[model samples]
Target: MSSDAELLEASREDAGAFRELYERYALRVQGYHRRRTRSDDAAHDLTAETFAQAWLGRARFRDEAGGSAGPWLFGIARHVLLASVRRGQLERIACERLGLFDRLDCRPAAVEPQTAWLEDLDEDLDRALADLPAGQRDAIRLRVVDDLAYEQVAAALDTTPQAARVRVHRGLGALRTKLNHSTEASR
Candidate 1:
């Protein structure tokens, strides 16, 4: 594979090079969107939008500050997926206003006890995460879920490695506190 710099340089001058770059990053970008959206069709749409935006904005690409174009494309995919989610939420609100759910399939499914407990745990985890400051939450996600190195997380967050470590530690501590409180309340 060509270096990102070389690929970017070629893409700046040639359309074909841009296509190659898109091919290289498209699957990863789609997977990122899929994880965020939980829908394959939406992921495909977001991936297409990402590439379209990238192609249109290729002339403005900067090799210095942004690092590889892959991450930038993934960022675009993330934004697009987020926008889609917001739009869907708004649409649901509008539909509720019009009483559309009266005619829709609204059957409820039975939940198994194990599944219910897992769902409750997931909700608790989400609440705990939301209670954290943005930097702390991001640090935890990047380090634990993304499996990024401390240095990489620090660089992404524009902070020092030590600061990133502290943020992750604090975030985990806050989560543990919430979990303990939740367990006590259940008992």
Candidate 2:
């Protein structure tokens, strides 16, 4: 169990030491990719590509510039994962335009209890959320889901904190109305 700095130093000299570094950081790299990309396979591929890039760029590795190799590797992985997601989005849009997914919506009826519960919740939430205006949805996602502060949300949305607060309030109000209506319908 060598310290990270020691491992990085050794890895700069020895290929075997680099392998040890990879083993140590691979899971973390994968986890970062998983969070960003939301796909295990994509994360695994991006993690592998990240290590490959790190290993190839070892000659350029500056201990001073990067406080930790782990963060450097993660940064590479994040860029790669984001690029992959953008490419995927483009491909999906192309496929949709070409009608590639038209037949896929016809296949259905695989239901597990947990999946069913999650699907129901997702549908309900989607409906509740659909009642919100786009501005309100953006505010809610930035503030609540992304856990950003009001100031941060305001900056991201290019609005004032008061405006962001208003949007979130309206979004929550809409959601509450939808939930009440749903409950009344159920009863």
Candidate 3:
């Protein structure tokens, strides 16, 4: 099996190698987007765009993080997701300016449980997350849940990269403490 680095190198000349890379990563990438977006259609589109961008930039691919191109691909995915959000914001502003806004109440519906353990974990995580301060919460979401780099998280939050790292570190520490407490209490 070709390493992700090897595949990326080959993909410079053979597009079929890129397909292999896509097959290896598409589902994982889609799942990452799905967890953050909570929308299947959006996840699909974001994953497609991530790969398309990856293919276009294959020549520039460098194995910055070991042998896997996972980090590079994810970096592209984050940018694609951010661009999509910016586009959505622009469209919303345009609609508001034109007085063409459709007032869709987009409340989150309850998730149906696939299993008891997963539900319990999710509930515990939600409780832990709710206990975090707003800045910490947002930082954790962007850095952990969305798998963005600290610099990217800083850019999104309009803070310094060190501040972003601090927020994520503190938030994760708090979450771990709370979750451990919760687990012990459960037992």
Candidate 4:
């Protein structure tokens, strides 16, 4: 099997190999953005940009943690999402400008969120996550939001596993308190 790292290296030499890399992770990448963004169209746009940028940066990419390129791709994605938030332009349409619109075959799927109650809970959770400090926030996201193991979380955050565990623990504790209070107030 072609490891993601090997595929990435090949992509640097033969651009077609980049498609293999994208094929391997496209769903994971798209799902991440789709879950976080308010609309599916925006997620599809960001997902496309993420791979496009990754392809453009293949020359500089290395499997720093000696593992799959999955983590590195995700890191790029998180940066892209953060930049969108910082610019207050999360809804900005971008694929047409990049001239790469033909690449993705994805379209907004037919679906509805579970219920309005669940949507309210999601909003509350987002507010709690936003209120966390950067360290704790990233830790919780890599560990919980992304379901990364402790070692993977540490590798992604450039921290020790122990520190990653601590941050996630503290972050979850704070989130619980915030949520408990919110629930009580609502009741």
Q: Which candidate is the best by lDDT?
A: 3
Clashing pairs in 1: none
On lDDT, who's better, 3 or 4? 3
Q: Model 4 segments beyond 4 Å from truth? A: 89-187
The whole-model lDDT of each prediction reads: 0.66, 0.65, 0.74, 0.70
Q: Which lDDT tens digits does candidate 3 get at residues 1-187?
A: 9988899999888988999999988977787667557668777888999999998899988553345776567668767777776656666667677766555532222321122212232565678889999999999889867979889999999999999988877776677567546545643
Best candidate, TM-score: 3
**Per-residue lDDT over 88-139 for candidate 1, one digit per residue giving the tens place of the 0 to 100 score:** 5666667677777665542211211111212232465678788989999999
> Clash number for every model?
0, 0, 0, 0
Q: Per-residue lDDT of 1-187 in model 4, one digit per residue for the tens?
A: 7877788888877877889889988877777667667567766877998998898888777544343676567667776766655433222235445554466532212322222212342576689889999999999888766979899999999999999888987777677677557645653
Q: How do the residues 1-187 of candidate 2 rate in per-residue lDDT, one tens digit apiece?
A: 7755566677777888888888877876676555445567666777888888888877666442123464356446655655555555566666767777666643221310111212242454578777788899889889767979899999999999999888877776566567546544653
The count of backbone overlaps in candidate 3 is 0
In candidate 2, residue 170 scores what lDDT?
Answer: 70
Model 4 clash pairs are none
State TM-scores per candidate.
Answer: 0.47, 0.43, 0.54, 0.49
- What TM-score does candidate 2 get on C-alpha atoms? 0.43
How high a TM-score does candidate 1 get?
0.47
Which is better, 2 or 4, measured by TM-score? 4
